[model samples]
Target: MTNATQAQLSRTAEFIAGAKATVPLIIGAIPFGIIFGTLAEPSGLSTAGALAMSLFVFAGSSQFIALGLLSAGAALPVIIATTFVVNLRHMLYAANLVPKVRHLPQKWRALMAFGLTDETFAAVSNRYLLQENIQNAHWFYLGSFLAMYGNWVLCTALGVGLGELFPDMTEWGLDFAMSVTFIGMVIPHLKSKPMWGAVIVAGAMAIATVTMPHKLGLIVAAVCGIAVGLSLQLLLKAQAASEAQSR
Candidate 1:
């Protein structure tokens, strides 16, 4: 094969590998997407609105929160602010990835940013962390993003259809799968004191602020977790520097 053809084949292989790596996450999110669809109409959204939200917003937690707010007759600004806060975690994800992706063109960066869901972040971050010399790694990121985005949209459509036939589908408690998936994602990454501090503080804060309105407690918990984690990380780095100087 010509060099160009070989390069194309390599990109395709990387893309497929990215998608394959995300299969477990996609499975976990399937029920969550369906649950969002089932709850959307009952939460006062039209079918088109629900699908459009999935296609456009593409943030499961934010979508669910938006549905709750809509059902409760929240103001437009409230819905926007709440969902925006819930998505602030994406900033952290982007920060973690900026170093790796900074060299890409703006259009590529923008597309990747749009596709950066939690699942994609986890899969891609793990890939970057574990593999130091990957070729066309962005292809792998694109593959994971496409797999997750397509799966979410498809599952949302399925849920919308199933919602009509089974109006009580939300009562099935399928969202628990997503919780398990998140826990699985987090547990494996708790390899340092900073990570442990973040998790512990975040969990405590979440429980403590569970009664906050509009799910603002989630934002509070996330902020607290990040604060503790960063503080610990900085302190550790300083100590390490001091120890090296002493030696």
Candidate 2:
């Protein structure tokens, strides 16, 4: 086959592979979404409001935490600030996506940014980094994003309905699922020295900030992790280059 034909075939395969890889993430989002909707009602968020946040913000942990703060009568400014801090992990997300989606249009970048939740970002970033070529990344991302989006909206409605049937999620232990899911997603990625450094630093920082009010500690953890990871990666790269030159 011609080079052009082979390239087209490869791109097609990537799109399919990306879509298939997203199924597990979509399945995971289902329970998380239901929990968010159920808790949101008690937090004084209307059903419509909970659904809207799921559709718009689409951040699982951040949205749930924001609802908690709001229910506690946090000031509007404080709520906004805390939400921003909790979601600042998206900056690390964006950095990871730079190489994959850099060639896409500006408008596409904005959409991807909007859709960049923890689960989606994790899947796409992992694939992009490992494959090292993201020619069809937009299609790949869209498949995962729409799958997640559908499950979230549907599950949120289910949770809102079930909230009437079952009142206390704390007893059900649904809230802790997010933490477990995050750890599961992260552990496999810390195979290298740089990645391990990032994980350890982030974990330590998160523990240190556990006493911080309104979930600000998550922001600190993510920032520390990203900074340490990137710095270590750069240092390692430099060392390898120097060794090559010496030889």
Measured by lDDT, the strongest candidate is 1
Pairs that collide in candidate 2 are none
**Each model's TM-score, in the order given?**
0.91, 0.86
Across 1-247, the per-residue lDDT of candidate 1 in tens digits comes to 9999999998999899999989999999999999888888888999899999999899999999899999999999999999998888889899888888888899989999999998999888878767786568899999999999999999999998999999988888888999998987788889999999999999999999999976778878988999999999999999999999999
Superposition error at 172 for model 1 (Å): 1.3
Please write out the lDDT profile of model 2 over residues 87-142, one tens digit for every residue: 77788778868867878899988888888877777767767777755677677787
> After superposing candidate 2, which stretches have Cα over 4 Å from the reference?
1-16, 245-247
Model 2, residue 19: C-alpha shift (Å): 3.5
Clashes of each: 0, 0
Query: In model 1, which range of ten residues has the least summed lDDT?
Result: 126-135
